[model samples]
Target: MWLFLSALVLLAAARSLDWQAWLADKSRQHLCFGAAIALVPLWMLQAGIRDGLEVHFLGLTTLALMLGWRLSQLMALLSLLLVTWFGIEPWHEFGANLLLGGILPISASYFVFLLSYSYLYRHLFVYIFVAGFFNAALTMAVKTLAFAGYVTWSGQYPWQVVVDDYLSILPLLLFPEALLNGMAITLLVVFRPQWVRTFYDRDYLINK
Candidate 1:
C-alpha cells in the first residue's frame, strides 16, 4: 500500500503539476520553498497515540488557496519529507501518513474552492467565508474522520480510544482551524492577491 500510494503521488505530480512553469519562475520557487518551510513547525506540533494516527493543524487549506492544488501537493510532499526528517513522523509510515494528513485535506480544500468558484456567487466575502473559513472547517472534519477511520481499519489503535480521545476534540479544533486558514487567506487576498493563485481580482472584486 505504501509503495503504491507513493508511486501514485509521483504519477499525479508528474501529470498534474506544471513543471516548466514552476521551475522557470524564481518567485514561485521562493514562495513554494517558504510555504514548505512554514508547514514544518505546524506539522511538528502534533498529538498522537497510535503509530500513524497523529493529529496536527493542517495548513493545506490555506496552501491550496494560495498555490492551487497541483502546487499544494508538491508543497505538502516537501513538508512531509521535512517532518519525517525531523524524526517527528516515522519513516516507515510515510505513505500512510502522507495520505491521511497531506493529500486528503489539500484535495478537499481545492474541491471546495472549485465548487465555490464555479457555482456560487463570485464575491470576495463568499471567497473568504465559503472557500476559506467554511472550507477549512470542513477539511478539518474530513481529515479527522479519515485519521480515525484509518486507525480503526488498520487496527493500529483501538476504535473506542480513537472515538474518545481523537474524535471527541474535533469540534473544538474546527473553529480554530477555520480561523487560522481564513485569516491567512484574508490577508493574502487583501494585500498580496497575487500570492493566492485561486483568487482572482477580476472574478471576485471587479464589479463589487
Candidate 2:
C-alpha cells in the first residue's frame, strides 16, 4: 500500500510539472539543477535507527517554498536517486523515502502556503511565520507521526519500543527544522525575492 500510494502521488506530480517551461528559462534551469544537486548532500546526513529507517533533516519545505512544489518534487526524486546510489538509502525502499521524506513535506508546506495566500493578511511576517516557520515544524511533526505508523505497520519493533525510544525525541527535531526553513525563507524574501518563486514584494510588501 505504501508503494502503491507513493507511485500514485509521483505520477500525479510528474503530470503536473511543466518541464518544457522550466527548461526553456536559463535561470530556472540553473536553479532546478542546482537545487537537485544540493538536496543530495542535504539528504545524506542522517541518523540511522535500523537497517531501513533513519532520521534526517529535510530541506523540502524550503525548496518547495522557493522553487514551487513541481520543481521541488522533481528535485526530491533526483535526490532519492542520488542517495540510493551512494547507499545512504536502500533501493528497494526508494518509494518510501520519496513519499515520506519528499512528497509529504512539500505537500504540507504547499498547503499551508496556499491557505495563507487565500485568507491571511499578505504580510511578510505572515509568510515567514505561518507559512515558513510553523508549517516547517508541522511538516516534521506529521512526518514523525507517519514514521511511527510505518514502523508499526512493518513490525520493525514493538509499538511501545518505537514510541518510547523514537517518538519521544521526534518533536525535538521540529524546532531545528523550523529554524532552518524559517531563516532560509526569511533571507530569500528579504534579499532575493526574485529567486523565491512564491514570494512577491508587490503582493506582500508594496501597498496597493
lDDT of each: 0.87, 0.83
**lDDT for each residue of candidate 2 in 29-94, tens digit (9 for 90 to 100):** 887778888878878888855655568778778888888877788778888899899998887777
Over 4 Å off, model 1: 48-53
Task: Please report the TM-score between candidate 1 and the true structure.
Answer: 0.95
Model 2 root mean square deviation, Cα atoms = 1.6
lDDT per residue (tens digit) for residues 88-183 in model 1: 988887887788788888889999999999999999999999999999999999989987898888887889988987898898889999999999
Note each model's CA RMSD in angstroms. 1.4, 1.6
Note the residue pairs that clash in candidate 1: none
- Give the CA lDDT, 0 to 100, for residue 166 in model 1: 83
